[model samples]
Structures are given as structure tokens and as C-alpha cells.
Target: MKIFTPIIINGLAVKNRTVMAPMCMYSAQEDGFVSQFHRVHYPTRAYGGIGLIIQEATAIEPRGRITDHDLGIWSDEHGLGLKELVSMVHMAGGKMAIQLAHAGRKSRNTFEPIVSSCNQRFNDKYDIPKQLSISEIKDIVAAFKQGAKRAKEAGYDGIEIHGAHGYLINQFLSPFTNKRDDEYGGSLEKRTRFLLEILTAVREVWRGPLWVRLSADEYIEQGHRLEDTLKVIDLIKHLIDAVNVSSGGISPSVPKVFPGYQLAFSAAIREKGLLTFGGGLINSIEEAEQALAKEKADLIYFGRPLLLRPFIVLEAAKTYAPELVIPQYERG
Candidate 1:
């Protein structure tokens, strides 16, 4: 099946098409350091035989955290634990990617005033964020570059920039969240400026399989849709390896979702000449194969299923790759 086949991105040859999507565990310490929970939680998926496992959203700065518990890469000290985490995952036979993120208006962990493309509040529940100044935006761009350096130091196989789910980058890309009239907002090109800067900055420090997770659709009328993202991809495909296609989170409106609801977006984006990581509620290997077969996505990621069954890959290899012998008695 295409699901078990190797695929190359840039120069990185992943052993299979299956990936454990980056899902926030929110289990880090108050200082945003890796905890025992992360040590055990991640490697289990590696032991399960996943080809690539992208770690959850890790903050680039203190105020950038979504919550106090979010993992961070804003400092070198954070690199020590992350390097060990990568070693553990590799020992268990999996490649690791780290998602560098900043929570924007959605941040609830910082005492400093929250900031975003515009002075907006996600809702009354989140703090009212102040609009970012030109210089401050440049500083945040530098922060992402610094975060990529830390990921490289941590021995991560890849780096994924969290440009999705109404985060800082998303806030700028979407029309609904970004109300500024300046260079960082308004027209699509201007709105894409911040993300372009971040990507450019990150590339200066790291030379691995780089990815950007994008909310292809905001699920709101005034927001960006798949077409908008395709345009964005055309501009940045030269700088990154893949696009992790996802939707929603720019607004409070809850979208009607279903299994494989996002595959079409990924397929569309892939058609636009770039690799994509696509999955939305897809739990079956058959579904994974169908997506890969149809060229809907270059890779398939399982989020909740991996949480419940970390051994899904091992279970799959029994049927698809009988030559393997991890669970010796059961496999043979």
C-alpha cells in the first residue's frame, strides 16, 4: 500500500507515509520545559512504529505560549531537554519534527500585554491583545528564527512553523482576525509579509525538512480559503518542504467537521505543486491508503487515534509489512 512506502522530502527519506500529527498535550512545566510526561508520551508513538512524529506547538517566547504549560524553544536551556527527547524518540525508531509556535491573542499564560496583527480579542475569555508595532513584529520574526536554531540544536529531524489555527501567523493571514491597514495586513501579499519574514528568518538558521502548518480555510466568509492558501504556498514553496493542511480556528465559529473533511483541501493544494500532510479524523489505514493513492496528500497524520492506540503502526505492519518482527510472537 502507498501508506507503507517511503517518500522523500528535500533530502529526508521517511521510511513510511504515516505520521503522528502534532497535537498539544499541554503537559509541560510552568517554565515551559519538557516534563516526564512528554518523555514517556512521545516515545511510545515511536515504539509504535510511526515514521515521523511532529511534537506539539512549542512557544518561541514567554508571551507566545498558548498556556503556561506549553513547551517552549525560546532559550538554549530548552534545547537540552529537547535534544534528549529527540534521542529517546530516535532510540525507539522514529524521526522527530518540532512545531515552533506563538499563540498571539489566544495566549493566556503571559502577564505582558498580548499582541497580534491587530488589537483584537479572540473572545472575552482571552485577553485583549494590543496591536504590534513595526519594530515589535520584526522582533517576533527574530524569535521564530531563534526557535528554529534551538530545534536544530535539539537534533530535530525537521522543523514545522505553526502558521495555523488562529495563532500569530494565522492572525495575520486571515482577513477576519487581521484588521490592520499597514504592510502586515490588508491585501493578501501584505498579509503574507509576516509569514514570509518568519520563513525567511527560520531558513537562515536551520537546514532541515522545514514545514508550515496552515489553516487552509478559516471556515468564515471573510477569511482565507483553500485558494488563498494555494496562493500563499506558491509564494513560499521554494522555502519549505511541505504544507500541513488544516482548517478553522481564526474565529469563534465552530465548523461542521467530519472524517476526511480536509482531504479535498490538501488535494487541491498538492495539485498546486507542493507536498501536503493531510488528515482530519482519519483513523483507518484503508483511509490513509486511499488518500495516498489518490495523491490527496504526501503523508497522512493520525491525531486522536495515536493517543488511544500508540501501537497502530505496529499493528498495521503485521498485515502490510509482515517482514517486521517487533511484537515477535504476534507478527510471525
Candidate 2:
């Protein structure tokens, strides 16, 4: 089926349309280094025949971590473990990418003052983050550049800028969170400036496939809508390879989600001439095939299912597209 077809993005060829979405494992050490768990967890999925494995939300700095245990690429020392992880994934016959992220106001594990576009708390339970100064913003941008450099040095196939899920980048993009009167706020173009600058910096050092994951719809009354994200994509589409479309993390209100709920957002972004990876609650090969066949998204990202069954892609291939199954696993 079309789900098993090979596709190319920014010169990087993936074996199939099945992608492993970046899911925070919260399994790293306090120093943000990869532990034994990650060493085994990622390669297992790679061996399972996933086309691309986007590693979890790795912090660009200590303060950016979502939890004390989130994986990181903030320093050179962190590269050693990640480099080894990348090698294992490559050996397992899968392409790998890493998501560079900062938790912003949502940062919960650090004692250092959390900084965001504006001084707002994600919720009553979370601490109010300090507003970032212009110079500090520049520093964060440089940090992202360094993160990209580390990813390249670690042999990552690609890098994904985590602009989604109410992180630092998403905070800037959403009006509800970004209440600044400065250049990084107000207009849509202004709100997207942080991400654009990050992409610009990352592109300078990393000449590989780059993806941006965006909270396409904030799922709130005054949050960023599909049209707003289209404008953001239009502004920076030329710099990145593709977009991983996901939604609703800017607020506490949970979106009414179902199978293929985010596909429409992906389709909308795809219509704007941007390649997109999208899927939510997608569990069956038929669902994946239907999404790809309908031209909703260029790739399908399996999250929870992959976590529960590491070899899900292999199982699907064995049942529906036997020719795509790995030869060694054929006997099974």
C-alpha cells in the first residue's frame, strides 16, 4: 500500500511513510544524559522498521527541561551517548532525528527561573515564568544553533525544531501565552519571529533535513488557529523540510480528540505546499493507508501504539504488505 512507499524530504530518503513521533520518555538522568533505557528503547523501534524515529523533546539548556529526567543536547558531553544511540538506530535500518526543545513557562523541574516570551504561568500549579529579555532571547537562539551543531556531530539524520505542544516556541506563537509588546509578540509575523530565528540559526550549521512540529490549533477561544499556523508555515516553509502537525497544548482545556482528528490540520498545511507528518489515535494499517491515500499527510506518526508494541510497523507489513517485511523476521 502507499503507506509502505519510499519518500524523500530535503534529500533524505526514508524507507516508508511510518514515522515514530517524539514522545518524552522522562527517562534520562538529572544531567539530561541518555541512560540505558534510551539506549535500548530507541533502537528497538528502529529495528521494528520505523522509517524515521524523532527522539523525544531534548532540552537545549538545563532550564528548558520539562522534567529533570528529559533527554538533552545542551552540551558537548551529552553528544557521546546520543551519538551511540544514533549509530544503533542506523544499524537497525532506520533514519533518526532529534527534537530540540525548551519547555518555557511549562518548565517544571528546574530551580532556575523559567523564562518565556512573557511572564505567564501555564496554570495555577505551575510557577510564573520570568519574561525573557532581548539579549536572553538572543542567547536562547544561539543555544538552539549549538544544539543543531551537536545533533550534526552526533550523526543525526535530521533535526526537528519543537515549536509545538505549548513549549517555548509555541508560547511565542500563541497569543494567550505570548503577551509581549516587543518584536516577538503582537502580530503573527512577530510571534513567529522566535521560531524563524531558530530555524535560521540551525540551518546555518546543520545542512540536513529539518522538521518543525507546530501546535497547529491551540484549541482555545483566542488561541492560534489553523490560518495563523499557515501564515507561520508560509513565513518559514522555505527553511525547513516538513511539518509535524499536532495541536492543543497552549491551555489546560483538552481538545476533543479522536482518530484522525489532527489529519485535517495536516491536510490544510499540506495544501499550502508543505509536506506534513500527521496522525492521532491511528492504530490500524487501514487507517494509515486511508490517511496517506487521501493525501492528508505525507507521513504517518505512530505514538502510543508504537510504545505499546515496538514492532507494530513490522506486524502491519507482515499482515498487509508481506513484501515489505524484514527478511530475518519472515520466518515468524
Candidate 3:
């Protein structure tokens, strides 16, 4: 059987198992508006035969942006430009999704980043983010909702809350960054309360497909573990439609491998009966097929490979299932 088979999430139908992973292009204008670069950069992959295309990590609030150059959906102005990008993907015959994110302690304000809790000398360049007051936390939640709303209005098929990579959401979910004592801190349940709250609120605004990107484990001790993710998945099984499995932080340096090194995590989520997307080192047709045959993941995501080969999915489909035909333009 081919790995590229139809899978359904909520009401959205993914045409194949191959997904185009969200990558940071940092090509947005200073005002956080999508440019021609964002439009042409994304839709072409879908045209090349990707089943799903996730927009880059978009900051929910101004302070939440990793770089001033990162994409944002905090306001309607952003939605205006994003509408064009989303439309391009759909017109190319692919499903589109957005990754709503906030860079908590990880804010790359080389100009002035913000931290959620206390400073640990990691704030030489980026401004130390003040510990969010009860009120500030509420505002942040609202920002997620606003971001979700904009994504929907912009015509995206779904939204993926970016809770991995030690960003704002991940910081609170992991034990290493969040040090609060209020309802938002201490104990795994309390630490997890923040992510659930955001998910609950975003769910209210976005009625379509809902997905979450989670770090299976930060790959660090005292940080989030597979058990932590499983616990959250248990709670989210009802609210979420799918879970995208990923790991590492903004600064990642892992040993190089062929592809599908992280399939085990997706398999864990799959055990829960919730649809899962496997990312990280996913590169060839054979690897993609093995992921499905072994039940490691339901969907496979491609990242860096898209930049090197725009029509990789089409090529892979031909290799894995030679009976499939390729368009004349895609052959070259």
C-alpha cells in the first residue's frame, strides 16, 4: 500500500500523506504583512503535489514574534494579505493550515525580545520578557483567539497551535522555563493548564480543523517528556483533530539521519486513535512509504526538501507507485 493515501481530519480531506511542513522564511515586511515572496513560496509546493501546506510559524502578538520579520496574524491588516496566500494554495488544489505561535522566552528580539518568567542571563540582546501578570496572560490567550480568527477569515482550512520549540506555549508546558506559582504553574497539570486554555479559546473561534504541534520531548531532562505529551493528547483527543509530531527548540543540533527519525512519537499518538503527522528528517519516497506501512504516522511532512526540490512529492509518488502519472511541466 502507498503511504500517500487520503486521510480525514475533522471535515478536511488531505488528498495524500505528503504534507509541506511550515518553515521560517522571515520574508514578511516590517509591518508583518505577506509579500509576493510568501505567496509564490508557498502555493508552488501545493501545485507540485503536496496534500497539505502549513504556513510558517506566525506570531499571535507583536511581542510574541521571534523576529520582527516573522509573519503575524494579530490584526485584520495581516489577514488582508494572508487571504491572498491562502487562496493561492487552495487554487493549486491543496489544503492549507496555519501554525499560530508565540515566542515566550524564546523571543528573538535581537532588537528587544521578551521573556515570560525571570531572566537567566539569556537576555543580553533580546529584552527579558517580564513574567506575565494574571491580566497579561489573559491578554495573551485573547491574542491566540484573534490569530485563529484571522486565519479562518483568511480562508485557511485549519490552524495548528505552535506549542513546540520552547516558544511561549512550550515554555509554560515544559518544566525548564515556566516558574510561576499561580494556577498556571507547578505540577504537570498546572503547567499544562496554559496550553489547554489556549486550545479551548482557539477552538471557540476556529470551527474547522484544529491541530497542535508538540515537541515529543524537548530532548532535555526536566523538560517535557513523552508522558507529558501523552497526557496532553489524552485531554486534547476530543478537541483536536490532529497532532503534528516534532521536537527541538529554535536552536537545534541533532545528529543527521536519512529521514523519519521521529516516527516513534507519531506512532505513540496514533495509538490514542488520534490522527498524527510525522516530521523531522522526512526525505524520500521509500521513507515516507515505510512510515505508513509500519503505522508510525498517518501523515508525513517535508521541510528543507521543498527548497531543494519543489516537485519532490510528485517525484516520490512516481517512485513509490510508478503507475501514477506526472504532469509534463513537472517532469523537468
Candidate 4:
């Protein structure tokens, strides 16, 4: 029942060990502005007593957006709605973090999905992404810093760099997707350079806690290996506060699923002596407890599960995981 206890991630003390994982609801306007749907949707979870809420995958630039409706922080104007949203979450007593991301070759929302580096055929029909020039890559890094600044200006508690799920950052991190021969590609050090640059750049603008979310593995052919990801982790160890571990997108296909399916990867990283969080297909109080008890993950990130059961944190504490909850919350 360790899941019910409060824990500090990146120097911020969350009320519980549960984090509302970033899930793309795609409820934004074309200009990357957050809409009423976002305001009503996000703060409600805070009221449900969720510990930490990681905002959905937000684009750092226009083309970096995954879908046309994806939220963006590429400009100062995008801060308007986000400011109000943060205010509401604060008033509700929940901590929030923004996930800054870029879709890379996966830009555009048509039936076809464009992938980075290769002119490979997509699972869907869409335009082939134009390979990024060196200058363009620099611009993307700048965009992430700008987004972090906006998040701070908007009153967010912290920011999380999205470096997973085959996004632009993850694409650059993996040799399978990043085929560029410039300094941005080639060796593991080169592939890892982009994420380090982003974390460093955002640190200048964002004074609050910072975290990096990474795909623990990509289920693709010639995809990134656990050792390679660990290398990336080692390189950026000093730049950020903690690593949020998830998997798949390094490869095209994911393996079969079960309860606590990805805790092992998080455990592996955590054993490296780094603070880490586990994500992907984890549900149930027992499973959550197992994650923390076995040191599989320092924290548990709930995506689809929280959507179905918003008050699961309290439920886990009061019902099944009493050992982890406070006596006050457990009393009648």
C-alpha cells in the first residue's frame, strides 16, 4: 500500500503516489489555444483528490503538434487559457505539470501518419514529413524553452519534457527513426543531445521542478534498447529532477499486456539509482501497491484507469491499501 503515501518528485510533495498521466483528448482550437472543454476537464480531476496531474501532450510548435487539435504553448498568446486553468487547479489543491512535445515525422492529422527520418509508408494516409534541417532542429529546442516559460507564466507548478512515444524528441533519441547524419544523429551521444538541450533550455525559463518522460522501450524493429535508453538517462541525470518511464514507439508494435506490465522497466531505471515513475497499462490497488512495494517504480502514473475511476486514489487508500493511507482519510 505504499501507493497511498505522499512522496516528493522533483522536490514537489504530491499528496499521493498517483499521477494523472498525460492523455491527449485533442480538445484544442486550431491556434493551439485551450478551450472550455479543457478547463472543465482538467481541474475536475484535482477535485477528485488525484495527487499530481500531468497535462496532455502539448506541442512546442505548430507542425510539432500531433493532431490539429493538440494543445500548444509555442506562443505567448497560448498562455491566456492555460493561466486560468492553472489557477483553477491550484484553488482545488492539486499540483500540475505540462508535458511539452513535438510530433516530428508524425505531424498532421490526416488518415496517414508521417514518420520522422525515413520516407517509410505510414499506417495511415498523410503527407510525407519534410526532414528537419539543422536550423529547424535548433528552432524546435527554442520552442520547448518558450513553452516552459509560458507554463511558468501561466502558473503551472512544473514542466515535463515529453521524450517518448515516437515524438520528435524520442525520434531524435532513437537511431531507428533519426537517420540524420549531422551532429543531431549517429551515435547515442548525438541522439541524446536533443533531449539534453531541451532540458537545459527549459531550465533557464522554468524555475519550478522539471521532469523528463521517456518511452521505456519502442516495440519497433531496430528500435531503441533498454541499455541505450539508460545511456540517455545517464547523460541527462544532472539536468532534470526525475525520469518518468513508459514504453513503446521505439518499435512499431508493442508486446502483449498484463497488469503492471511496465513496472519492470521503471524498476530497472530506478535501480540505476535514479528517481523514476512507471506507466502503461497499470491498474488495480494491488498492482499499484506491488509497484511501490517491490521498488518497481517510485510513483505510479494512471492514464486510462483514472478516467474510468477518478477517485481511485482514495479508494485504494481506504479499501484495499490501508497500510499506505493516513489514519484520518481512513476514519469514518
Candidate 5:
């Protein structure tokens, strides 16, 4: 019942709080066009009763893709497929957002040189990225602005900046990866400059609800901690609408995970007078309801669960909010 309630963020109304967390399908073509799989994939969840479906990491540039299969918004041509995707979700009675992202040194595109805040490799298996020059950094920042313009043209109801999972923004924010002594790195304030610039650039075009995903715990002894993340939030909290919280991503090795594992991270960030999205390994609707009921997180995000059970929201809605169970409704 709690999850079925409508709420507004930045003047945009979502039907419920059960968010379909952005999970990469890696199903795009090499050219990064939305494939037949994506056409059916997201709208299925929308029809299944997902409140807000955040499309997986969409690359801002070809070289920024985590893999060649990642969907792209680097050019205007990508908008046609995205607009069709949004139309499908709207027809199914759900709202959707897109996560604009860049891979930095983690990029596996191979043809183009990988880049990062410093000349570093996440690990030996990946290329040791060339340290980004000042001009290159500005170019990437402008790319994000352009991505926002494309997302708006495609009719996304909201935008969630992918600043998590050791991606480009995370690399710049972390002391472990950003060894730059320039204005983009050094003190915490300087370390946050890159993300701030991206946020400012995105705001120039996107007026919809804006959310940002953050890797709350870097999971290494000297890597970023929740304290560091809170400080970063302090700098950009006013720039975005909510922080989608997750953890243990700076390291390639998976950290220990348990039900409600990441809720504490979101709780700590919410204490700073900011809204947050929280869920990791949460298995049941009951646990999700509890998270919202207790106000541990404002939004409950389902990732693996949704993959395993795409119609889970529809099933839950049958008991929780039967009015939304319109499986036969005309959806075209």
C-alpha cells in the first residue's frame, strides 16, 4: 500500500514509489542503437506496473561506453528509438527516466582511447587510461549537456545522472582514482568540481525531475567512504532532486551483500536533509514497504528482482492497489 501512493518530485508526478532500477541489459547494437530487445524490455515493466522505469546507463559519447553494447545518446539519431521507447512506456501507464553515463577508464570500447581524471587503470585487465586534459574534460562536460537535450527531445519524464559504480563522475569524485592536482581535483571541494560542472550543464536543458546515483561506500580501506559521499552530496544536493544510493562499486571484487544492505547508506545520507533512493538485495515487497514506511528511503528500487520477475509490480499491485492491475488495458 505504501509503495502504491503517488508522489511528486520536482513537479513531476510518479504513479508510485516502486522504481525499476536501471540495470544494463547490454543489448544494444555495436552502433548503440536501441535494439528490438529494448523496445520490448522496458515497456514490459511499465505494463507490469512499474512506477518509474530508469533506463540503464546510456552513454554520452561513443568512447564513454562501458561496453560497445551500451545504448547511446551521443548523436541525434539515437533519439528516434528512445522517443519510441518513451511512447511505449507512456502507453503502458508508467513514467520513465534515463541515466546519462560515461565509463572513463572503465570503457571497453577499445577503438578510442580510454580516459580518466588520472592516468590509471581500474585493474590490469583494463587499459591504463590516458589522463584527461583540461580541454578533454570540458568536451565531456559539454557532451552531458547535449545528452540532456537529447533525453528531453526523446520525452523522458526525468533524468538520473549516473555518478555511481566507478563510472566517469565517480572516478573524478574519488581520491583513489583522481590524482589530479588541477582545479578538478585535490581538496574535497575541488574533487567535486567535475560533477558540479556536469550538473550545471545538464540543468541548462533538463527542467524535469533530476536524480543522481551515488556509490555511497567505495569498499576499500583508503577509497571513499559514506562520509566522503555525504560531503559530495552537500555540494550538489541543491543541484539535483534525489540521490539514488548504492555501495561497494569502486572495487572490482563484489563486497558482502545482504537484505537491506544499502539502506543504512541511504539513511545516513537522508539525515543530511536530502531525499534518497535505497535498496540492495531487498527480496520482498514487504521489506520494500517497510523501508518506505520507516522513511529510510523515499524510493524503493528493485534491480535483480525485477529482472527475475518483470511482472512483480503487477502481482504486488493486485493486493496492494488493485486499481492499477489493468493488464488488458489498451497499450500500444
Candidate 6:
């Protein structure tokens, strides 16, 4: 099936179209060092036959962590453990990418002050974040660049900038959150300036395949929709190799979701002639194959299912396309 077909992007080749989406494991030391859990968790999926595995949201600064235990690349000291994890995933024959992220107002790390594009609080559950100054914004961009460098040093095959899920980048992109009248706010172009600058900065240090995860729709009034996100994509498409499209998380509003609910957004992005990774609530091989056959997305990302059953892709191949099974597991 087309789902199992090999595809290459920006010189990085994967054995198949199955991508393991980044999911925060919240498993790390207080200082954000990789724990033994991460060392074992990621490679397990690689052994189970995932083509590309994007490691969870890794903080670029102490205040950028979603939780205190989230993985971090904020320091050169953090590289060794991540390098070991990458080596393990590569040894298992899986191409891996690291998602460089900053949580902004959504940060739950109480040790440092949270910052965002504006002073808005995500909800009553969190504190109002300090509005980032122009210089501070530049510093954040530099942090992202340094993170990209560390990602390369850690032997990652690619890098994904976390601009989605109401994180720091999303905070700037969403009108509901960013109420600043400064150069980084107001018009859509202005709102996208932060992410554009980030992409440019990261590109300076990491020449590997670059991906951007975007919240394609904010699911609220005065929030970014697919069109808004498309405009952002248009502005930076030249700097990225693929777009991972997922929706909501710009606020507390829950989206009406069903299987493949976000595929339409991916299809729209793909229609604009950009590669996209799309999947939400997708589980079955038939669903994955149908999405590919219908040209809904360039790649399928399996999240919770892969977390629950690491060998799900292997099982799918064994069921419908046994020829695609990894030879190591063919004995079964």
C-alpha cells in the first residue's frame, strides 16, 4: 500500500511513511536530563518499525518546560543522554527528529517566570505570563538556534520546531492570546514574525530536514484557522521540509473530534503543494492506507496507539502486507 512506500525529504530517507508523533513523556530529571525511561521508550518504537520518530517537546530554556520533568536541550551538558538515545534509535533502524519547544504561558515549571508574546494567562489555572521584551524575544530565538545545534550534536536525523499546541510560538500566532501592538503582533504577518525568525535562526545551525508542527486551527473566535496557518506556512515553506498539522490547544475550548478529524487540514496544506504529516485518532491499517490512497497527507503519525502498542505498525504490515515486515520479526 502507499502507506508503506518510502519517501525522502530534504535528503533524509525513511523506510516507510509511518511517523511516530512527538508526545510528552514527562520523564526526565529535574534538570531536564534524559532519564532511563526515555532511553528505553523511544527505541522500542523503532524496533517496532516506525519510520520517523519525533522525540517529545524538548524545552529550550528552563521556563520553557511544560513540566519540570520534561526533556530539555537548554544546556550543552544535556547532550550526552540525548546522544545516547539517538544512537539507540538509529541502531534500531529508525530515523529520529527532536522537537525544539518552548511552552510560554502554558509552562508549568514553577521555578522560573513564564513568558509569552503577551501578558495573557492561558486560563485561571496558570499565572499571567510576563510579556517578552524585544530583546528577550531575540534571546529566545538564539536559544532555539542553540537547541538546533545541540540536536545535530546529539545525532538527530532531523529537527522539528514546536509551533503548535498553544506553546510559545502558537501564543504569538494566535490573535486571542497575543494582544500586543508591537511589531510582533496585530496583522497575521506580524504575528508570524517570531516563528519566521526562529526558523531562520535554526536553519543557520541545522541543515538537516526541518519540520514545523502547527496548530492548523485554534477552534475559537478571533483565533487562527486553517487559512491563517496556510498563510504562515506560505511565509516559511522555503525553510521547512514538512508540516505536521494538528488543531486546537490555543485555548481551553475542546474540539469536536473523531477519527481522522485533522486530516482535512493536512489535505488542505498538501493541496498548497507542501508535504504534511497528518493523523488524529487513527488506529487501523485500513484507515492509514485509505488516508494515503486518497492523498490526504504525505505521512501518517501514530500517537497514543503506538504508545500503547509499540509494534502496531509491525502488526499492521503482518496483517495486510506481510512482505513489508521487518526481517527480524518474520519468524513469528
Whole-model Cα lDDT of every candidate shown, in order: 0.90, 0.93, 0.81, 0.79, 0.90, 0.93
Q: Mind giving the per-residue lDDT tens digits that candidate 6 earns over 138-252?
A: 9999999999999999999999999999999999999999898999999999999999999999999988899899999999988998998999999999899899989889899
What does the lDDT come to for candidate 1?
A: 0.90
lDDT for residue 239 in candidate 3, whole number 0-100:
80
Give a tens-digit lDDT track for model 4, residues 209-259.
Answer: 788888877766577768778888889988877788888865457688887
Q: Per-residue error at 44 for model 2, in Å?
A: 0.6
Q: Write candidate 3's Cα lDDT for 1-332 as tens digits.
A: 45667888889998888888888888999857898898898888887888899989998887778888999888889999999988898888789999999887777745554757444323455556778777888888989988988898899998999988778888787777777888988887888787888889988988799989998877767677788889878876778888999986723434344467778888998899888999787777677778888889888898998988988877766666544434555454
lDDT of 3 at 162: 92
The 10-residue segment of model 6 with minimum total lDDT is: 319-328
Per-residue CA lDDT of model 5 for 1-332, tens digit only, reads 78888888898898988899999899998878999999999999998888889999999999899888999999999999999999999998899999999999899996688999998899988998999999999999999999999999999999999999998899999888888989999998998999999999999998889978999999988778999999999999888989999876666968888899899999999898777889998777889999988889988999999887988877877777778889484241
**Could you tell me how far off, in angstroms, the CA of residue 151 lies in candidate 5 after the best superposition?**
0.4
Write the residue-wise lDDT of candidate 2 on 217-301 in tens digits: 9988889899988999999988988999999999998988899999999999999887899999999768999999999999999
Instruction: Please list all clashing residue pairs in model 5, or write none if there are none.
Output: none
Residue pairs of candidate 3 with colliding backbone atoms: 104-168, 109-112, 109-113, 113-127, 114-129, 115-129
Compute each candidate's TM-score over C-alphas.
Answer: 0.97, 0.98, 0.93, 0.91, 0.97, 0.98
Any runs in candidate 2 off by more than 4 Å, and if so which? none
Candidate 6 Cα deviation (angstroms), residue 330: 2.3
